[model samples]
Target: MNKLQIKYIRQMLGLSQQELGHLIGVHNSLISKIETGTANLQPKTEQAIITLFSEKGISDNDATVINALLEKRKAV
Candidate 1:
């Protein structure tokens, strides 16, 4: 996935960099690097996040799905 997708997913899940890193078994600085477009996620880590998001009922649509989920979370 792209950096924007990663950023959007993390935000949609309302996770801080440290929280997201913990979820994906990475470092907080790595999450910051990815969000800032200075680094990339390995395929395995990407798969882990995709699994997590899917588990949370976030569909594999477009960025629109991410935005919708974020809004849905805020409503709750």
Candidate 2:
């Protein structure tokens, strides 16, 4: 997923960057960097976000869109 999507999802889940990072086993700065476009997410990290949101009962449409976006980025 892209930076905005990441931030949006976190917000939707009522999580701060630090909290999301902690849940995903990363430092908060990493989350910040990702959000600011200073860094890119690894595939594993993206998958972790997806899995976490899925567990939190995010809509299937949102998940599908995220996966599609990730795939499009991979193709670029």
Candidate 3:
């Protein structure tokens, strides 16, 4: 997912960066770095985020968009 989508999903889930970080097994600052384009998410972390969004019932279309953005980011 793109940085904006990560932040958006976190907010939608009513989670602080700290909370999300805990769930994903990262420090809160890593979340901030990820959201700000200063860090890259490992594949496992990406899957965790996808699972989180899936559990929240994010639409298939939205998930597609997020995955597309992730692929694009990797290309960069």
Candidate 4:
């Protein structure tokens, strides 16, 4: 997942980094680094994130678009 996607999904889920990290089996610091675009996530982590979005009725394409929108919001 891209940084934008990660940040948006976490926000949409109403989850703090520690909460998200607990759900995904990662450290809170790792989640922070990822959201900050300072970390490259492993493929397995990406797959898990994708699955989570899919369960939330977010298609892969929609996820991408949402990520783009979130990035635009961050830029503004």
Best by lDDT: 2
RMSD of 3: 4.7
Q: Taking the tens digit of each residue's C-alpha lDDT, what string does model 1 give over 1-76?
A: 6676778877877888898788878899988998798887778887887877777666688556665676687799
lDDT of 2 by residue, 1-76 (tens): 6787788778878999999999989999999999999998899998888788888887669866866776787799
Candidate 4 colliding pairs = none
Candidate 4 residue lDDT tens string, 1-76: 6877887877887888998788878899998998887888889888877887687777889887897887788899
Ranking by lDDT: 2, 3, 4, 1
TM-score against truth, every candidate = 0.73, 0.77, 0.75, 0.80
**Cα RMSD (Å) per model?**
5.8, 5.0, 4.7, 1.9
lDDT of the structure predicted as candidate 1: 0.78
Model 3 local distance difference test score: 0.84
Superposed model 3: Cα runs more than 4 Å off = 64-76
Q: Clashes in candidate 3: how many?
A: 0
Model 2 score (lDDT): 0.84
Comparing 1 with 4 on TM-score, the higher-scoring candidate is 4
Q: Which number leads on TM-score? A: 4
Query: What TM-score should be assigned to candidate 2?
Result: 0.77
Candidate 4 weakest ten by summed lDDT: 48-57
